[model samples]
Target: MTSMPVESPPKRATLRQRVFRALSGEYFWLYLLLLPSILILIAVILIPMLFAFQMSLGNTSIVVVAGRGSINNQWVGLQNYLSLLQNPSFWQALRETLYFWVVSILIEITVGIGMAALMNQSFFGRRIFRVIVFIPWAIPTVVNAMLWGMIFDGNNFGALNDLLLQWHLIQSPIVWLNPSALFPQIPWLSNALSYLGSNLAMNSIIVGDEWKTLPIVAILVLAGMQTIPHEFYEAARVEGASAWRQFRQITLPLIAPVLTVVLILRTMQLMRAFTLIFTLEQFGLPVLSIQAYQQAFAFGSFGMGSAVSFLIGLIALIIAYFYIKRLYREEL
Candidate 1:
């Protein structure tokens, strides 16, 4: 009897065959789907970023002249960065930017978390209240800044001073816009604290910015709160857990991730804060963005401005990397 002929095993797919299969499969569809976004990002973000890096490496004058499109610039590698590092104004601006970022984000998180907790409760008109809280956020940044400027007007026309005077809060209308009176003295503190009163102008801007952006943090936190299962709270309650205990044990840990996200986002936003501060009080208080603007446009030192901008960008990247690492560690 003739035995059944043995069948040969199927050959392994060649590299070209695998590539052909992938091109005809789900991966190809995904690549097609992502093509438009990738192209747009290259055109809008990547190309400009590369060009800006090139500009930062050279002394590109930003001055606009009729019939002249651009100024001739000489390549001077790292000179702009070195100059910015040694510049007193750059240091001052960097300090002020960090101060604003830290102070504003702290206030925002504190107030935002409080508001989120309050809003999460079942209350009449809660929806309406949420909308009201977001009104400043809904308004354009320019309008928000302008509105605050009007309210903080140092003269009789100022609404804040008007209310304060009506309530007998201040002896006289305070000069809110005066750079000389920007920071108030902390009489109890010594040395640098006393000198740090010069930050009142920046502080005022910080307050305005916090008002506009606090709702964003609150909303994010509220979303986080929603993700927490009610059963967890119910179980804790059944276990005789106090409200504070429940929050500390259950709520805080769950919400910490969202808070980290809020912190990173707020830090980035405040680091590059421009429109509000520029509109409300231009050059009165210097932050990094304002400094970059002054260097690039005011003095036509595009290279130095670009260097400062890139430095701030570097800081943002570092912070983002740190938090992302923390996020991964927490997951582990």
Candidate 2:
């Protein structure tokens, strides 16, 4: 029996058809609208990122000891990465950076959620209080760092020191900025913790960085909190639930999604906390971004700087990928 010839699957769309489909669909206009943005992003971000990766592989004249005047594009072939791996200072800096990032982000999330809850509640002058709390978030990181830097000005005349002294908290003006001046000679920016001590001098300065950044986390949480409905709280209240109970049952689950998104976003953001760290320079505290800057700019080691930058960007990309992945999963 002659079977009917099998119908071939419809011919696959050409590159042109694929392009047309992407450009003509509901979001196709959006794609068209966003084409420029994507192009710009590639041009401004991706290109530089790739170029930095290439630089990381080469020994730039800036960092290496070379003979005669010339751009030293020596193809070192992973020596830079090897040197980075072997360097004790790099490890120390990495340790310090990890500690700083983890601690600050944990505090920011906790405080951010608390602040968001407070803002979501009914209170007198809530608007004003929110404005005040949000002021820091609105301020530029450089400005916030500058402001805090002045407050901890390593002098008695600094705002915080002045206030503390005025309150009779101390008979003498303590140099807050000086590492060697802490009660037990706690190192501030001038030294690293010698051994694993529960309390380190670097902790004091990191608090400044935390203060400057926590408000940003809080603002993001507040935006999340606002999306939650009041009906859930009201429903819980109708059942004679305790405030804590209401929070646990009603607020927690409802804001969990927001919390997740905010956590990831803020995690990525805090990871790139370079500007604040740079401005609040205490040589003792070497966070990743600060280390990158010092390597590239101070030492003029472009290859090393490129390596540092490449690693940072790699981190940011991973976080972003996971963030978007979770978001997609939730949506589905």
Candidate 3:
């Protein structure tokens, strides 16, 4: 028998050859397609966030010197954060922001689910009704704020005041935007729960925000509802399940993931609510976002503003994390 020649080991791929192979691979096109978006995100979001964080750690106030202005970004090392923690106004703003977020989110979720359930049903002109429901959300935030402002105007000619006057609900026109305790008659209760005191201003803001935002929640919930199989409802009906029971047992559990997403999104949006509140009340109500705006623009305290913004972002992240964790726990 003839001895077979030993096979030579294949040469290792050079670094350049490996790189070339990767560049020519199936995923190369996908990475190339994503490059522009990644670059844009880095330019628009990541860079600004880094700059803001740096600013938060230092004083970035502009100082004028001999007809020339220069940014005084002297490192203060968490002084801005420390000062915000020590400030009573900061705490008050945080409380107001949380109050607004909680109240508005509760109302939105409840009303939105109801509206979604209604729209999910088959009825005459259901499409038209859905369109009408969505119209408020389609309206721009600034426009919505201005429209509500007119309705809630303190003047006698305001829409609400006029209606109330016609109905003989009050003897005089009410200043709807006034920041007064909701229950001044119950001083103890008012003192105990100052944050929830039904201030007309805050309530009006909530109403406007809800009117514009509720439709979004409804739409989202409706989308979630659509994903539920009609067979589920059919099976429930076969078991003689009532409408409420069907909803509670089948609809809710199935759509929980969607609701969790909605909660996270709405919480972030409500926490950063500035345009609607600012347009409606300006600096009248001190919410966290407005406080940040005032610190940056009104008071020229960019460092403080950045710190507040960073805090808001951190809070949003924490809330989102909790929501996601709970969702996973429920799934398990």
Candidate 4:
């Protein structure tokens, strides 16, 4: 009985056993908890997107025959997309969309930053004013559209017209929603303002949209401002920096990230502004979203509609990617 019993090596774990071990690990429960949300995202967003992309690649349409409705889809490669590129209406809509997006974003960002800076200051009823400022944003989009629509109703009964008349601003009620009514002459200016879309109609939409969305930008900027330490301002003040200099140097740089976020979100939202435009002017101002809707429902051209929709999404992604990449680059 000289030697101890020979020791045996541990057996390797089987694949099933390894997998089971992983599933039983600490992070497994976290992944398990996220499963439902992942599944929902796939079902709701990914699946529909895939289907829409497929439809965009084909000549898809709806046909009604003998009291029956059916889909007519045919593989057409990039024909729908190509045709859309060649379409004048598509380009016009794109121009109008870009114009609206640029103008509205500029106004919103400017006014929003100003409002945020004001609100961030210590003042009487500041909290109450903040609440009141957010009320427009909280109002339902449909209701806001209706309210603005009534105000710009192109009739004497319209609130804006009524007010203007009361103030002796105009001798007669103006057709505020009429695209052609405001700037019919002025050869050079007409072309330039055509980007404004239907003159007052587009401008009216911008105003309405600004009223609802400026609050969002202001609130976000205000949050960003709050994150900044008061000591920064104090230090700047010690150096004899004026208010404008303090904002330009200290406030803006610190809040650049928040502004980036606001830009991305507002750009995407503006691109897909359908309900407000539709309610205010119906098919009169054919922005991208309305174009897609008209192509699909009005003309029964599902393929073209899907293409336009996909294009809008693609543009949004591109813009987001640009902003995010620039942000990361600046950070690094």
Error of 1 at 219 (Å): 0.8
Q: Score every model by TM-score.
A: 0.88, 0.80, 0.90, 0.89
Model 4 residue runs over 4 Å out of place are: 1-25, 63-70, 181-185, 195-198
- Global lDDT of model 1: 0.83
| Per-candidate local distance difference test | 0.83, 0.71, 0.90, 0.90
Residue 139 lDDT in model 2?
78
User: Which 10-residue window of candidate 4 scores lowest in summed lDDT?
Assistant: 175-184
Please give the range of 10 consecutive residues that has the lowest summed lDDT in model 2: 189-198
Q: Between the candidate structures 1 and 4, which one is better when assessed by lDDT?
A: 4
How do the residues 93-148 of candidate 3 rate in per-residue lDDT, one tens digit apiece? 88888889889888977898999999999999999999999999889889988999
Candidate 3's C-alpha runs over 4 A off are 1-24, 63-70, 196-198
Candidate 3 residue 322 C-alpha distance from true site, Å: 1.3
Off by over 4 Å in 1: 1-24, 62-68, 180-191, 194-198
lDDT of 4: 0.90
For residue 117, give model 4's deviation from the true position in Å: 0.6
Could you tell me which 10 consecutive residues in candidate 1 have the lowest summed lDDT? 189-198
The TM-score of candidate 1 is 0.88
Q: Determine the backbone clash count of candidate 2.
A: 2
Question: Each prediction's Cα RMSD?
Answer: 4.3, 4.6, 4.2, 5.1
